[model samples]
Target: MEIFMKVFTKKLFAGAALSIAAMSSAPSFAGENPTSPIMGIPASSLEEFGGREGVRAWVESLFYYIMLDNRIAPIFREFGNPERQIFLNTQLETMVLGGPNEYQGASMSAAHADLGITMTQFNAVVEAAYNACERNVIKYHTCNQLINALAPFTADIVTR
Candidate 1:
């Protein structure tokens, strides 16, 4: 399982990196403003995951993987409550999928400021998210796109 996770993580990161690069130079779709992609994700991508309920299920799967990961589980145990899970679902829906933008949590930096998170721990969490995406049967490119959307928050999240 460990070896499999290593390989999967490598592929996921590579795919996400390439997707980000390509998107950076990609042209706008017909009748779509150049910046609209930034403002909101195409509804088609959401549909690929079976819509909003699927996103919530993905979040549930993410936490399941996170808690199973010995490397990061302890660090995240504090956030295992039902309320926190709901907040995470909404936050991810807003942040990665361009949903309603109803996230009311603190900034990522502020949220992790005192946690002293290391780069390795952060990457493990990202891996878990990718795993969740796969487990939810989201398309490869859509998963990559979601990861790309989240890439910018690394600086704010990896405090150590």
Candidate 2:
């Protein structure tokens, strides 16, 4: 399984890197454009991230990085194929990015209540995710958009 994750991570990196390169060649339509929605994230932004494919790769890469980190891996060590849950994560991200809201999971607080996670651990996970975003070619501004959207859940996610 570890070997499989390694393989998967390699493939995800390769693909995401390519996507990023492709997108970077053109200016992002998400920033300061007429189509930018007044109340929420713009769909063009999500499309820039490669829509479902980009989000899936980001979430999968997030899990891959999490598992690789010794400080954070213990939190997820019990789970099998965290990759399977990437769909749900993708849905939640899509929703955040002004797409459909099909994420039907527990609230972040309710979800992490039993884990006793700390701020340090949470930050580590976020940092690891940012690392993946860097490798995936997700821009800094776009990544911050996601962080801002999910910030409200910090209190719930960090129980300790």
What would the TM-scores of all predictions be?
Answer: 0.70, 0.71
**Lowest-sum lDDT 10-residue window in model 2:** 31-40
Evaluate model 2: give its lDDT: 0.63
The 0-to-1 C-alpha lDDT of every candidate, in the order given, reads 0.63, 0.63
State the lDDT of candidate 2 residue by residue for 1-160, as single tens digits: 3354334334444344333232223222353222221123445768766776798888888888998998889878864347546777886676566555455566666668898887778777777778778878999888766655565455667788
Each candidate's number of clashing pairs is 0, 0
Which tens-of-lDDT digit does each residue in 70-147 have in candidate 1? Answer: 988887786446458666664545334534444455656666788887777877877888899889888878876666
Best by the TM-score measure: 2
**Candidate that would win on lDDT:** 2
**In candidate 2, which residue pairs clash?**
none
Segments in model 1 whose C-alpha atoms lie over 4 Å from true places:
1-41, 79-82
